[model samples]
Target: MPSITVRNVPDEVHRALKVLAAQHGRSAEAEIRDILENAVKPKGRKKLGSLLAEIGRRAKLTDEDLKTIEQVRDKTPAKPMTFE
Candidate 1:
């Protein structure tokens, strides 16, 4: 394993990191390692736009079908929601 040093971090950031580490029941160093690992890792879930594009490709929707769907969607009125 390799070691790295991060110098001159702001006081507030250090304080916040310490607080977060305590909340997660770990030392600041462990919390930072976890944070770094998560930041570098790819997310498991696909983004909405990517999923929609894939679905459209699989469905083989034509330009005319898309135009008609857009027209219908634009003309439809939105339903109101009631909260008790």
Candidate 2:
């Protein structure tokens, strides 16, 4: 297996990784690895409305119900996001 080394890791990023690891019942190292792969991926993110609609489906909402939900969720505010 190949190994990768990352530099310039800020303390806040490290701490966030620790918390994420705990949330997913994984070791910090494993969580950091998962975070690294996901963060570096080239795939485009789902649109906020699409993600919300999927969540609604998982929650067993009917399509007629999800139509209204998507409309409302799409209107929800978008916070300023800066990818580190």
Cα lDDT listed for each candidate: 0.93, 0.86
Model 1 C-alpha lDDT per residue in residues 1-84, reported as the tens digit of each score: 988799999999999999999999999999999999999988997899999989988999988988988887866578999897
In terms of TM-score, the best-performing candidate is 1
Residue 55, model 2: Cα distance from true site in angstroms: 29
Distance (Å) between predicted and true CA of 36, model 1?
0.2
Q: Candidate 2 overall Cα lDDT vs. reference?
A: 0.86
TM-scores across all candidates?
A: 0.52, 0.41
What does each candidate score in C-alpha RMSD? 12.4, 14.4
C-alpha lDDT of candidate 1 relative to the true structure: 0.93
Give candidate 1 misplaced runs (Cα > 4 Å): 45-84
Candidate 2, position 54, lDDT: 84
For model 1, name the residue pairs that clash: none
